[model samples]
Target: MTAGERTGEKKDQCQGTGDINFKDRIASSPCVFTIGVAGDSGSGKTTFTQSIRDIFGEDLVTTITLDDYHLYDREERKVRQITPLHPEANRLDQLEHDLVELKEGHTIEKPVYNHATGRFDPPIRFSPGKILILEGLHTLFTPTLREHLDFTLFVEPDPEVKIEWKIRRDINKRGYTREQVMAELGPREEDYQRFIAPQQQYADVVVRVRFSKYGRERGTQDKVYQVSLSQNKITQSIEDVDLSIDLFSLLSLSDRNFLIEFSHEQRNTERSGELIFDGELSARMVERLEQSIEDQTQVRPISVFHNRGHVTATEVVQLILAWRIIHQRVFLERCHHLDQIQG
Candidate 1:
């Protein structure tokens, strides 16, 4: 039962994130949206989602990583001469089914893929929350999956930077040796070319993370995050964006060169909106941007961890997503109120 149902609270319309069956409260819970973030491995998907959990609170959002759908264990994939990136390697149909059920206000026992043991563990059962986040490489690869998302964010870290990040993460965090990391990258690139990067064409937002060459031409790798907003899907106009700097640039990707948009409204002393930053960044800037006015109704600062001197590219991307998620929520909530009053 929903939290409101158990406590007998008069649950009126809300931006969701409450314990309520979404289907039963569809009219009051139009903001119960699903977000899909897709990219190749080590593109900071886990880090980004972790930051959201910190900000929105652990119980507000339900996150599902598509990687756990691997049909074969590591040894099984090796024996079959197949990599996990291939569509055949994953149980996507099941993933779609569970997401559909979750969308309709049902619980699901999601599968768990254990990387260290190269095997499948028991499934973890859970109910859906106000927001559902579905992330993986092939999330947009399939039409069925794409149709289910309210917002799609494609993470594009620079090739060189991604490799560096992958090596560090796999070896240091995942217990993989240097040699294993290299071997994995080659097959991953092949898989990406075949199945991953192509999905970016359908994304509503493409988060491009690159080690900025503008940073003093030094040996250091301070990064810049260019969050390109696709004007086609989002309802917000460029005129409405309140970013300060007029620094504008255009770039092409996915067979369409999307115009980069920028603006920032003052949100807690920091510029909040689709804006650009190319130099050193502070963790506090990220926190302030997240708890912006657009979504401050449900806003709370995410606990931040950074290096002594600067914030990492991964951290910045998380804040970018948090910005998008919160803004989308606020927009929907207001729109729904207007619709109800008219009705």
Candidate 2:
């Protein structure tokens, strides 16, 4: 039984970390929305979810990286001749326990993985937020860990794109030479295929990103993307959310060079729908779509696509994916309400 059932009092929705009254109420109960994001490193997982963070703000969203659960430090892994992508290299069992504790609204001293130093730093206390994001290579690798995720996202970038992104990041930020980064790819990709790629089949939403022809012609391929969003059909309808695209408005943007396609198919034996977007869309074009979603669902402005002269396909997909997550949140909320009434 839930704390709410035992107390027999309806739990108020948490406003954020700053709301004292809500915090007090939550202290007596556990209410959290957990989202698991899985992807190979440098696959744009963080870039893709920027809109969700914009909507909920950091105060209400707590993100935990699975890298911290690494069983071996960088040098140790080198000695062991194993990549971080290997399943045996992480503390998966402890990750599961920590997730469960966070779900119950308990604080945990989460370990820190220093990316720059390639070592485990001192652990820090982590408190649950209204929304919890568990992002890493193995979030969906184990069934028990998957069970605690309210929503799952998988990012699959084109192989070339992944390599380019990783090389840039590791070289510029992680202090790796281009040659060293190139050498690591052979073994890393092998490990990624064996241990990480399979998690894509389990995600409710899979985002595939590739270079856009428009960007290639303009020599801005790094700044632009062609993103395809495959959404597993909604599990069940929720009254509070609706997924609708305004075709009329979408078609009216004649000045923008863009492409949008919708199709239905079976992915991994599950029915799913895919929307592909390519080209340089004007900010107004994206706003019209966002407004359409808000008008239909009466949801507040989601604003993942920042107002600019042109919007990239990545930003457009982020808006749509964020909308789906909003729907998931509402559905989970409704289920919680039903449990309260039954109790």
Candidate 3:
């Protein structure tokens, strides 16, 4: 199967319903739940965000790409001999300001970064939705920006996988030659290590993708992915839904060879729980678990995802992340209420 097949294609379906108390609370108050997704270019950050989008329909979710904050266009970066991965190449200050504005349910004129031309387009008046997702290189890089985000995620793909994804994307989507893509890697990696990698420490969750060891032993390494989601221990206190996987049920019903590993570990000097999943997964099992999630959260299934009828390790990660986001929304609401009472 192709990569698209693994992740599943989008299906046209109606939205799902959930406990409307939180939704109504937000609608009345007009607060935005901000999420920050940080990753190197082509690290599958877009794909990761799409999973969250699937959980909440388009009407409630809005996305902003951080590339729009680039301080210099492609030619300018080349002239300056600076990589876009460097903090100086991006207007992080403007990003912090925009994030604050969005969090306060205010509209802002946002810039647009055109990948095809490696330049920016005219600014557009952008409005904040109920849930605003800010994704880019330095999203979680600074303390000020992190303060604005309700939840933060970082995506780190293995070096080889990142190179493969980047080369394919820059050449196919961004109008770059093979030689140009290869030549830029040296400086980009240097800047990435210095500026981007350290931001992982601030993330509430970190996703690392690499070649599947099981697939490697079976000589299918290129096609299978091993994805590890490392979640910060601090976020555990607010978990409102049960996320335990029924391993017994999964093992009995699934025919595919797979590996699942769970561990408590320290990532960047922070306590975190990491779960790794690889190989083909059981679709029915995942769907059942999703239903359980909705049941506990007291939300009706969003028809878009409920009707998709396909499952992979990717979808599982998305479901968990979506659940976290929903509860984070609730948690924020409670905090707001508490502050009002105290005041």
RMSD (Å) per prediction: 10.3, 6.0, 8.0
Per-residue lDDT tens digits of candidate 2, residues 155-212?
9999988988899889988888999899899999999999999998878888998778
- The alpha-carbon lDDT assigned to residue 276 of candidate 3 equals 89
Local distance difference test values of all predictions, in order: 0.61, 0.76, 0.74
For residue 223, give model 3's deviation from the true position in Å: 6.3
- When 1 and 2 are scored with lDDT, the better candidate is 2
lDDT (Cα, 0-100) at 112 in candidate 3? 95
The list of candidate 3 runs beyond 4 A from truth reads: 1-21, 216-223, 234-253, 303-310
Q: After superposition, how far is residue 101 of candidate 2 from its true place, in Å?
A: 0.5
Report the C-alpha lDDT of model 1 over 278-342, residue by residue, as the tens digit: 54344444444543422344332344454433454445556666655655555454445656887
Best by TM-score: 3
Q: What are the clashing pairs of model 2?
A: none
- List candidate 2 stretches off by more than 4 Å: 1-29, 215-222, 239-253, 292-301
- Give the higher-TM-score candidate: 2 or 3: 3
- TM-score of decoy 3: 0.85
Q: Tens digit of lDDT per residue, candidate 3, span 44-136?
A: 887777855775558778999999999999999999999989999999999989888898988999999999888899999999888899889
lDDT of 1 at 133: 85
